[model samples]
Target chain A: DVKVTQSSRYLVKRTGEKVFLECVQDMDHENMFWYRQDPGLGLRLIYFSYDVKMKEKGDIPEGYSVSREKKERFSLILESASTNQTSMYLCASRLAGVGELFFGEGSRLTVL
Target chain B: EDQVTQSPEALRLQEGESSSLNCSYTVSGLRGLFWYRQDPGKGPEFLFTLYSAGEEKEKERLKATLTKKESFLHITAPKPEDSATYLCAVQAGGDTGRRALTFGSGTRLQVQP
Candidate 1:
């Protein structure tokens, strides 16, 4: 079974502070994704990484960035956290071209 | 744009009752369609994947069938533990390396004893 792990399950940060969310996958998948889930809005992609050091912006990428320094780890960074950024963040990984994805437990971020 | 939509935003059923959930999609080209189950405050757990129109997959009490434009998940004699939000996603024709998945709003199921 594929296992995806997120560094934190819940986090609280003050406005204007930088925040980091870490994700790791044991399956060595080539694709990693970051998504924020909200009520009525569902899951919206924030950023994705296809390979080490390669990243692409998804539908909503403002105020957020990603890092893929290694194949098994992907990180989401918030340049300046704001109250609007408070939401449940999910990380997923999968083999390139494969339709199935393994997801992490998710990080619920609260930006006060 | 590739889009996925799920019907019946919420469902309630008595134990031993059976029902189906619907997922409709529109994409340039279909690569795959996936089903997942999510519990409260947790990530989604993968259930099944259907690739072609006539394909079908089954796991225990749940069965999934795909047509040209839609997919249906049938739960037979559901139990209380079977209650959860069912999500559907589609992988459309684009960059294969990207592995992007477009998901629906999901259908929340509730089963009572």
Candidate 2:
């Protein structure tokens, strides 16, 4: 079984503060992703990394950025936290080009 | 581009009552469709994956059926522990190496004991 671990299960940040959500996958998967889930919006991809040092923006990537310096770790960075950015963030990993995604427990952010 | 839409924003069922959820999708070409169960404040857990039309997969009390443009998740003899938000996602053949799954809003099922 594949395991994806997220650093923070919950976080509260003030407006304009920066936030970093970290994720690590045990399996040697080449694809990793960050997504934010909202009540009516579903899971919208924020950023995805195909491999180390490579990244692609998803549908709603305006306020976020990502880093994949190594094969097993991917990080999501919020340049400036805002109330609108408060939501459950999920990290997922999969083998390159195929297979089901293994997800982390998710990081819930609350920005005030 | 690929798109997915799940019907019935919410559902309430009594124990032993059976129900089904619908997922409608449109994509240039279909690769695979996935079903996931999500609990409140938690990430989605994989349930089943269907590759083509007429394909079916079962687990415990849940069954998932897939077609070219739609998929159905049928719950039989539900229990209270089965309550959760069921999410549907799809991978498009035309996506090439992107490997991104487009997800729907999900159906929240509440099974009462």
List, residue by residue over B1-113, the lDDT tens digit for candidate 2: 68899999999999999999999999777778999999998889999989889999999999999888899999999999999999999988754445788999999999999
In candidate 1 chain B, what residue range of length 10 has the lowest lDDT sum? B91-100
CA lDDT, candidate 1, residue B66: 99
Interface RMSD of each: 1.4, 1.1
In terms of docking quality, how is candidate 2 classified?
Answer: medium
Model 1: which residue pairs collide?
Answer: none
Per-candidate TM equals: 0.97, 0.97
What digit string (tens of lDDT, one per residue) describes model 2 on residues A1-112? 9999999999999999999999999999999999999999999999899889999889899989899999999999999998999999999999887667889999999999
Which 10 successive residues of model 1 chain A have the least lDDT summed?
A93-102
- Single out the weakest 10-residue window by summed lDDT for candidate 2 chain B: B91-100
Could you tell me the C-alpha RMSD of candidate 2 in Å?
Answer: 1.0
What lDDT is reached at residue B90 by model 1? 90
Clashes of 1: 0
